[model samples]
Target: MEYFLGVDGGATSTALALCDREGRVLGIGHGGPSNHILAPGGEERARSAVLTALNGALAGAGLESPAFEAAHFGMTGISRDSEPARAFAAVVAPLLTARIVRIESDASVALAGALACRPGVVVIAGTGSVSLGRDPLGREARAGGWGYLFGDEGSGFALGLGGVRAALHAHDGTGPSTVLETEIPRRFGRSLGEIPLLFYEGRVQRPEIAALASAVTAAAAAADPVAVSLVNTGAEGLAAIAAAVVRRLTWPDGTAAVAPVGGVFRAGSVILAPLKAAIAARAPGAVLVPPRFEPAVGALLLAMQAAGVAHSPERLALLAATWELRSRT
Candidate 1:
């Protein structure tokens, strides 16, 4: 009757999964953003998100007073052993009765879930971009993740902003004509000339701008040269990040799995093709693959590890099966 909990607390949302010793997921819960860095109220906000998700998970699992053997929190902006991590650990300590509690960066759990804790790199390109990798020796390295202001070159925000800039340029007759002029404006229901005001007036934020990436992807799918170029450039930037991680970590076999995770990759081959090609050119040893499990399950695996549970194929298989079933529903 040992229960384990895993929490994936991100910039926009938090998710919790509760499971049994055999790896069958009993419940899943979601809540608002828990990232202490991006939002105000820092620790308080993260604490609320974690509690909401944990309560939901407990309710869904029909467990009112079960003692969890272990719980892991993989949170964004809270690196292992850092000040933010320590603060979060203090904030959640009273809420959980787990014997073992571990906290780490979201990328740590992402790499674990993407490769099932095997040695690999994960390139996350949501609103922002980051590349993290682990070696067989448990050593880790990362590239990018500098946020939208200075970095995140191949992220949704980057692509979306690129589209907006292209639209503006086209309007000013400084750039080649493209459908982005229409496509970008259509997303905000504004004319091309009025789009800058949306950002200047604080009417649009990062997530909204990131959402524009879909329009760019759609335009690329429709064969707009400017949109296609933006997608390719974005792919190249992501490839560079992955390549940087590949270079930082040692691969005895001269090969490593590189999983692309996040919204930007939804463009499918429009982005993947260029990403694969660019990675081949930049880091030949890196291979792009689909993530084996979502980040929440990854956190669960870490929780199991802290509880001294072996990551046996049978246990992993059980977890994977449940993940597949849950994802479908």
Candidate 2:
């Protein structure tokens, strides 16, 4: 019984899955941030995380030893260019014992997962944002994903930044007052007066600021105008990214399926109404579809493909069913 491994390494977390030749998922594991760009000592940290997850999965399956015939990793920050791919290969080769290992950017896996290797678009709005699509002819296109510095519109960072601006504006009586003024301070365990000291004293990570996005969402749900506008703006920005992908792919006009993923979408989908409206206004027939499979599953599919394995509907169903059963346990 040959086994294959799939790893999805994200900026904030990582997931690994073990599957058999027939596509039955034997075990699954998870770990913390594996994106090298964000985490120092990235290569080693990633290696340790992957190994830990693989071992956990094996233990869950009651297997003392297991050999992976092939493995694939979809990770953020791994370049698509050949030169960078080669560099990454060197960094990762010493870490795993698999017979074959393939690595690609997380966007590729997200796209494949959402569409099942078929042609469609995927918009991911998490701590960051990116829009990706693949044409039926295997052509791929992308927009955004420049990180929080330049782009990442509609992402957690974007929401957090907007929330901060709103809070500050309210403090100065320059903008519409909202509940964020109170909520932001509460999150940091201090009054608004201490926020500057907390930030300048190196007591907080910038990403933690984005953690307030959930509170903003809650406030919006409670009818806070400022929060409502912030969420609406985020939805609009995400929709614009999706629209760009649609235009690049030139998908047919008749409810073209678009899969939305990432934490931002999960937390703020109510805001997506305007995004849907915006897309429809421009593309006329685009429909948003929730992802049927996670990005790790897509990595598994790619691993299977790399190993010359054909994925039938029956096989995929078996894998999904097994995973669902395991999840319940």
Candidate 3:
């Protein structure tokens, strides 16, 4: 009857799950933004989000305080090289009744979630972007997770930046722009004339600017050339990241499977299509797997692994199916 708790704390939101020894999910919970790096009082915010979700899950399962055998948390902003990760772990450990509290990079949990702890590569394209791969020898390599400022190429931020660039280019008569010039203004309820003022007034977060990625996707789908080109370029960049990981890792076989996750992938396959093409061009036999579970479930899978629970193919399939169903609800 050993219970395990897993938390996936991301830039935009957080998720918590409780599972048993057999991998049966007992309860689940969710909370607000927990990207420790970006949030003021990030450590406290992360701790509160996780604890609230864990308590909610316990309450859902008809328990006052379920004793957990182990707890694993995957959070953004707490890097492997930094003290923030340790400090956050210490805060969580004392509150948990669990014997162990493990803290890891959110990317690790996302990779684990997609591959079920199996050796493979995962490319995440959310508000930010990163590619991580695990080889058969358990060696892990990562590329392009530098956040919105320096990197995050092929991410939401990238897409939004492209959108703005396209609009500005059109305004300046440097590039052929489309309806976005008008559409962008309509969506934001102001003319391009007002954009500078809004930005100067601190009405926009960097991520909020990147939030335009969704609009770009929709515009591309609706046949906007600028948007389409932006998506295609983004896909190419993501593919390049995946190929680099594949080249660095020593796969038992020449080919490796790559799983794509995050909002960018979930929004539409148009972005992924070019990425898949690029990966195939380089690694002809590489398999691109649709993510079987959200990263939170991957966090749970990692927790289960840490607890020494083995996963069977059938169980993994069941878990994937269950998670997909749960996600839709």
Best prediction by TM-score: 1
Runs off by more than 4 Å, candidate 3: 37-40
| Model 1 poorest ten-residue lDDT run | 35-44
Task: Report the CA-based lDDT of candidate 1 relative to the real structure.
Answer: 0.88
In model 1, where do residues sit more than 4 Å from their true spots?
A: 37-39, 192-195
Error of 1 at 116 (Å): 0.2
lDDT of 3: 0.80
Could you tell me the C-alpha RMSD of candidate 1 in Å?
Answer: 1.7
Q: Estimate the TM-score of every prediction.
A: 0.94, 0.90, 0.92
Residue pairs in candidate 3 whose N, alpha carbon or C atoms collide under 3 angstroms: 113-298
Q: Write the per-residue lDDT of candidate 1 for residues 1-329, one digit (tens) a residue.
A: 99999888877788899999999888888888788643468878888898899888788778895789999988988898888888898888888888888999988888888899899999998888999999887898999999988999889999999999999999899999998987788887878777678788998677788889999988999999999999999999999999999999999999989999887888898999999999999999988999888889999999998998988998899998886775555
Worst 10 residues of 2 by lDDT: 79-88
| lDDT to native, each model | 0.88, 0.78, 0.80
Q: Candidate 2, residues 300-325: lDDT per residue as tens digits?
A: 88888898988899878987898787
Candidates' RMSD to native? 1.7, 2.4, 2.1
**Of the pair 1 and 2, which is ahead by lDDT?**
1
